[model samples]
Target: MGPPKPSITISQQAFDEMVKENIDDLGMDPTEALQDAIETLTLQGVDLSGIVTCKEDPVIQSLDRLKQLNSNWTDRIGKDGDEVMDLLDKLTELCSAEGSGNAAIGTRNGGIELVCSVCSKLRGGSDQGLVSGLKTLASLLHDVQSGDTFQRSGGPKMVMAILSDISQSSNILNGGFSVVAAAATGNEIVKESFMELKIDELMLQILRTHGEGSIHSLYDAIRILLTPDDNRVVASQVYGYARRFAKTGIAEVLVESLKEGLSSPSLVSATVTLKAVAVNDEICRSIAESGGVDAVLRCIDDSGEQGNQTVARVCCSLLSKLAGSDTNKSAIVQKGGMDRLIKLAARFSDDPSVLQEVMSIISILSLRSPDNAARAIEAGAGDLAIQAMQSFPGAHQMQRNACLMIRNLVARSPENRTLLLHNEIWGLMTTTNRIFTMFKQSTFFQELLI
Candidate 1:
């Protein structure tokens, strides 16, 4: 049956171990961990169909307590609130499922009743139940909201908890199609909920995953996050999540925009996403090896400083970050970032204000690693940076920056300072002086001597 549940199925013994891991991690009771693992694995369609079908497993056995406990919840909230919450904590810690992209849940009327009860009149004294009850309540709310009217709760904690449910596969509570449809219907409310939890990656996962029905709001959230007027304060939240959990579909969306050529400031989402995926070695190696590299490099060749300075900063940062590593670095250098930066500098060569930005990026990448700056020199970045000292017009911020970057190389090894000499590191001292009134003791100026 069911094509013989994958041989990798979690056996009873293994499930018990996970339960031992306590609610925090490896500390969960093995029995509980096993249950959580199974639930998560089950939702992801991990090979536990056999165990699920066995119908006699300990997890299913443990769930029997839930039915009995449901009736006791009213009493538990009154008499044993803390104990109940402890049980719920164990349940969430052990049974937590990750978002399965397609989170299938339903709107059972009884579940609705439970939803209403969280806000119902309080009991006498401290609620008898343990904090575990809150976890169970949260799980119920997340599942119910996935397909019920509780989708628009006014409370902030309630919303964060629902989004936090992503740590557990959204599949844990996929009861029926009605749940999915209901969730789709209240898309906007779900997005509004995220505005509060935007800084939480798990919450971002929920928004990006289940929040798809209200994708426009998701996009708008990004817009507000990166809006020029207020970007400095919260821009990191949007960029941070996009990098951490951008949807698979985004690649196609961005490629289309990049090909459309400056139609949409592709960097805001696309570049940020590429850099995000490029972070961890596992994700980076995969994308770095694929055609994704070419797409990102081309994005740089196409876009300008139109929307989201941070996005642009991340793009430059990605190229710079990948500098030392052979796999991604080679790809960046080969893709013409060096030459591209040269052209960017030349285009704004006469405009000091614009060149200030170009030079600042140069300073960042220069410090990324000596070899990257070396590559910049080989690509003629050295000359551009030097000439930029003059046309930069404002403070010799460029020269000062270059001198400081050269210092890092100097501190680690005198050879790094020697390497900068080839970039004509010494010649910029006068320019560095203009940029820094204190010339000799100034940050970059000191870098020049070393």
Candidate 2:
């Protein structure tokens, strides 16, 4: 009939009023309800990015302690004072414990330093814990591979100040494994329990911290926690931070900090954090899709110069997983990544290891996948890659990898395969199958002739 009348629907204002009334009847803040909903999503592994909030969590209660220390004198002394002093004493002893903390009373290259520093600072004037914490941390720094060692507690205990206190700290920024350089009495522990014991409590307490200076060791602990196995905390921590920051519908501040570290001139702990955070596929793809990859690709491309060497290495390692797909390959090429990689090879022509890494990336793209390989060739990586694989004599690892790339290019293209066959690829393989097999099973044992 006359294009049917529109169906009746409640008025927007009427509906809004009804919903608000319903929400009010529930005895809960809709804002908090929304937060609870998001946390639910996070628990289920959903992309709550841009929908969360890195709340302005006050630094831990220690701030009050610091202020109180400045306020009343005799108000907190004697047995109470002795308690503080003893804590300072025990922590100093524990912090100064060395050699991985295995032997009795031995110094450890662990979080004992962090505990010592914080407790020592708390002890103050007498500065028992401060001196011990600093000395232990410094010594541990010299021998320990990372900083997320655990002593007193897990993430929550270490980052207690970030959630509450931070005054005693001078500059507890992250360098590598989170550098907690105190003003001789502050900047302490907790990155991730990469120490003797794994922690299980107060994760929320630890993850809430998004402040600095206001806390003693947040930066240093975060840095340490982001190292390798320790880096495992990233997905949850960032997801929580993302969930918190996203509540504003603007992830700029959170993402900006993440981006700042990625783009920092110093390829230090921040850069390492970026890499760790990027490991979350959702976070990484979002970052790549959001143009973080462009910067990383730039670093990847500039890997030619010695000045950019560290950046290149970091880029290579960080971008490894991102480059595993055709779309990413295409994106990288469109973004000028291929050219830079080629240039890097040329600049470091003598450095076969660098060439090998670059070639491995190219190979990863071209592996038995014709279109991608052709795209790689079109990007001008083929000749240089081939030459690198062949130019290096001796160790067949590089040659084997090079052979595999060339072999893949051949397998993907009938013409390329024919040409390679014409070139006696069998002979090449016969020359080095053993070396190439270490790369990947699919690549090395593909039953080439069939």
Candidate 3:
């Protein structure tokens, strides 16, 4: 024990091998014996790169090839053939291939690095090159495998970074928003990530700067963020997100876009997006402040004889929501919005869908506002409501809503009550009571009975 003996440990196999080598017979130190065993294993060509389990994944191998050949892939753009489509298909396949745990490999093995490099090149690249590169990135994002990876690895930031540089080129901007839209569609995580970047402002900027071509993607992106195609009720988080849109003047831009005509996709997009946020008091006020009532009324008028029923329905519903605010009700009535609505109700009296929305709006206008109630009566809304109830006798909700509106019309406006009574509205009271008694416990129905 002159010097304490050094200690070392080796795997059983290595220990046995050392023993078989007669290292103990030669009385070598334990550390020297372990060192000899390690040298033997290292010389045997064992790959110590920490990837011992997953065999040579072909997907990872192909991704590595693409990363190396990304420039070659870029050069294929503008060649005018199956080349671009082929490039897109290949990139899409690579991204999808990452799903079976290959994402981990791709993430670690330069796949995301390649995307960043492509984004960098596209920022300064020619328009054709930019379009192609952006499209490729969009398709990659559409694939579930690369979507999260793309978002987490600065993909969204890279996309946002290049947007300003490409703002002047419609093709380039459209392509950029395609990537943004794809990243946003059905992927809340990425959509929230984009929200953090104030992507809505960037979107409005696109509409402001690039004009018509950017409308589709901007609408699509906003739609995905706000409405979310699911059946779930719009949560407070979505409303909170929509407040940001209103702050960015989205409500104003949307109202102006309505000038695109009834059937215009942009027009429909604008209307629908506005409706989604109309519940916010500030947003509703913004709509009215932005001349939305007049613009919307004009759209309803423009829909004409063969008006888009869906457009009419959604616009009316939106106005109904906006009309909840007193100022909005005044704006609507002043803009002849109430007159147009009455006309629509009369014209589509047989269509329960349109009539339902009309009655709903009339009810809102009549509630808590004597002036608005008088305006509705002046617009022949009382007559229209009675007609809707009588004509759609079987339409339960229609009848209920109509009766409720009649109640609201007469609650504060004696003039309206006199107007309805003179028009034989009392003749429909029996019908109203019958319907109201059916749901007597409902506060609305109870109020209607009174």
Candidate 4:
């Protein structure tokens, strides 16, 4: 625009050397040396347009750029839109760098307020900007301080507004849900804030409106809301949240979503959310009555056919949790859950983690029910457990879970003890006697042997 802005260029190495010279020769503070370098280059008519000035840490630099861009935001999308998106990208990268302490740095630099302001400004104007802002905000809120700031600054309300806007794109809604999930994780006050905003109701409405398209992030947020805090004192609040979610009809909606054919990611998230929501025996029974058991078994069958071990593993875990209820245990058996689980174990025989989940389910199902125990044995759970034990001799959890499943299978059913004994469990036990020594001192292993 003005005589081509007097263009000139320098290599990155050259720029670094210049900054080094300013610090080494001039004996200036690093920040002062950087500023001096920038000033000298600008006065010399050198274009340092694409250079990283190193004036501040990356988190602070990004926040400052975001603040500048927000001030210049206009109705018409142009260069400012591109700059806004770039800043968001840089902030997201900085905050997510593992062990960099950038998230904590960001919180100290008022990143929460700046990013939230950017999101609020970008609302309804730039979908790309709004999406990126939400993503950056999520990363910034990884720690407790950022989450606390977000809650105090009415972040939940802003995020809920973004999600409630029907005119927003699916990408925007997904990003907003991710922010909710991140903010609610391990932070009691933020969780309470989101609860007061009726985030659960909003989540159910979004699921109903968007169906499978938004299931992954929405269910992730739902799961975080229902999960207990790490502190044992607030653990009871999780049960309260679960009850609230159940009363909100989320259990029925979740079961319905499972009935619909979901992709692997969506199915995994749905099962995880269901697991978190089934916090008490009463809620577990409610979900079971809502056909949650059959729905989950169907998910296992579908995921197994697709060779998606992750979905199968999560579904098995949910089935195990639901089986805590006596009624759900029978329901799982009635729905052929044991057969499905045993087949899943066989299909994923190479994965000890999957086998552990399967064995855990069997342990619960056979806890006090001889029929279920017999069904488990009849469906080849004993064979599956023995095979898992033999294959994964070094897997402590797999071995422990197998031992528990065997104990439960025989605890109430004498016929199962005879059947399992004849199934060569004793031979397998002898083969694993050395490995079982790791647990020999434990009473559970002693019971398994007897």
In candidate 3, residue 320 scores what lDDT?
Answer: 86
Model 1 superposed RMSD (Cα):
18.8
Rate residue 268 of model 4 by lDDT. 66
Q: For candidate 2, lDDT tens digit of each residue in 252-328?
A: 22233335443543334334445544444455556566665665665555455444555555566555556664567
Candidate 3 per-residue C-alpha lDDT over 1-450 given as tens digits, one digit per residue, 9 for 90 to 100: 364443333343444466447455767665566566556655765322212123356645556555555656554433432443344446555555533443344444555657666656545545565566676566555444356677777878887887765345777677777777776665666767888987888888877776643546667667667755322234425667788888888778788777666656677777877786675777788787778877778877775356668878877877788888888887778778778888887678778888888889889888888888888888888778777777877887788777778878878766776677777766675656668575456554334334
Query: On TM-score, who's better, 1 or 2?
Result: 2
Put the candidates in TM-score order, highest first: 4, 3, 2, 1
Cα deviation at 308, candidate 1, in Å, is 14
List, residue by residue over 16-73, the lDDT tens digit for candidate 4. Answer: 7999998899899888888888898889888663355555567777778777766776
Worst 10 residues of 1 by lDDT: 100-109
The deviation in Å at residue 18 for candidate 2 is 82
Q: Report how far off residue 367 is in candidate 2 (Å).
A: 4.7
Least accurate stretch of 10 residues (summed lDDT) in model 2?
51-60
TM-score of 2: 0.54
lDDT of each: 0.45, 0.45, 0.68, 0.80
RMSD of 4: 10.1
lDDT of 3: 0.68
Candidate 3: RMSD to truth: 14.3
